[model samples]
Target: MSFDIRPAVPPDAAAACEVLRRSITECCVQDHQNDPDILAAWLGNKHPAMVASWFESPTNYSLVAVRGDDIVGVSLLTGAGKLALCYLLPEAQRQGAGSALLRRLERQAIELGMKTLYLHSTATAEGFFAAHGYRRDGNVRSPYGVETILFWKPLAEGAEPESKRKRFCNCNSA
Candidate 1:
């Protein structure tokens, strides 16, 4: 199904929050493992009020993907170049909504003069981010018990990536 991506408004908070909550609890089974405690911790702050606050923040750029009158995905980018939140309903996966939302955020970041965009991706989304040119920075365990992969993408054209500047090769390989 096709999705329309647009800037999120205050009225979108409730649906956006629902998307976030359902995406995590249902689609992120690999990360949360259906553990009640972990799910609670992960979703503790994912409420409509908080989502509305994010939409209202001057430093944040938020977007929602809508299929008809229903919101199927949501994303947020911070002024500091963090892709803070990106979520889609379980039914919306693999339908290009996530990719479209991510690409739009990347474009906005570039337009805003951001040099790089970074995000912590769950195991469920690691491959997706990598496929979109994000490089692995490292990993860290979240408070909710999932080990998330740290990924970053350079947004500037012709920028020298750190990986290209340094290389380690075993002498015996030659």
Candidate 2:
């Protein structure tokens, strides 16, 4: 199936949140182990209302991959160069959606004049980030005692001399 990757909007929050919740619960079982408290605490900030707020936040950039009417994947990037979120439904895994979403965020980062990008990956997603050129930068314990792997990668070379909004961003799509 083909997926259309586009910037997220407030109206997309509820559906996007479903993909987030389902992906985290089913795909990250290795990290959470079906622990109720951990899941609650981990998902506490993921409420649908909160997700909607992110769509309007000036300092954040979010994207979604839609297949027909379903939101199959989602990603969020902060002005501080953090990849705050990246999740895809089980059925969408292994396709190019994740890579496309990530590449778009990296391009947006370069356009925003960011030289470095970082994120904390769940145990289940460590390989995905590593495969995208993110390195092991450090480790941080989540509030639930899960060891999240911190990763960072330098944005591509050539910071064009132009306005931030119009800068030329040549992000790699590999």
Candidate 3:
């Protein structure tokens, strides 16, 4: 399907949240070991306000993938080069949406002059990130009892001069 990827606006907050909620509950539940409470806390209760606030932050780069009017995926990258969140509806999986979102974030990070990128990947997504050039740095315990594996990629120097480029290769599919 054709999709339009663009910077997220304030009105896209609800759609982004919904995408995240559904993605976590439906696609990530197995990784959470079928724990409803953990799922609820992780997706809903733990930091709903914070998540919403992220969309409104100038320092946070939020992007949405929209197939016409439907928001199929969302990703957030902080100024620190940390990949804070990435979620796509199940129907959007394996269709290049996630990869597109990640690439956009990587570009944003490079524009911000960041030299590295990192994320905490769920069990189901560890392989995906690994295949995309992120190296596992070990597991970290989340509040919901889900232990996420840390992954990171460093930008290759000389790939782009610091002054003119707004994108860099993290060595993932580049």
TM-score of each: 0.89, 0.88, 0.85
Q: What is candidate 2's lDDT per residue for 56-114, written digit by digit as tens?
A: 78988999998888899999998767788899999899988899999999999989989
By TM-score rank, best first, the candidates go 1, 2, 3
**CA deviation > 4 Å runs, candidate 3:** 45-50, 158-174
Better model by TM-score, 1 or 2? 1
Residue 68 in candidate 2, Cα distance off native in Å: 1.4
TM-score of 2: 0.88
**Cα lDDT for residue 143, candidate 1:** 62
Task: Tell me the whole-model lDDT of each prediction, alpha carbons only.
Answer: 0.84, 0.81, 0.75
lDDT by residue for model 3 (1-174), tens: 777889987778777778887888889966777788787667654144555677788878989999989999988887766687788998898999889988888888887878878777889788788988887776777656787877787766633222332222221110
Candidate 1 local accuracy as lDDT? 0.84
Ten contiguous residues with the weakest lDDT in model 2: 165-174
Candidate 2's C-alpha runs over 4 A off are: 156-174
| Pairwise TM-score winner, candidates 2 and 3 | 2
Among these predictions, the greatest TM-score belongs to 1
Ranking 1 against 2 by lDDT, winner = 1
In candidate 3, residue 4 scores what lDDT?
80
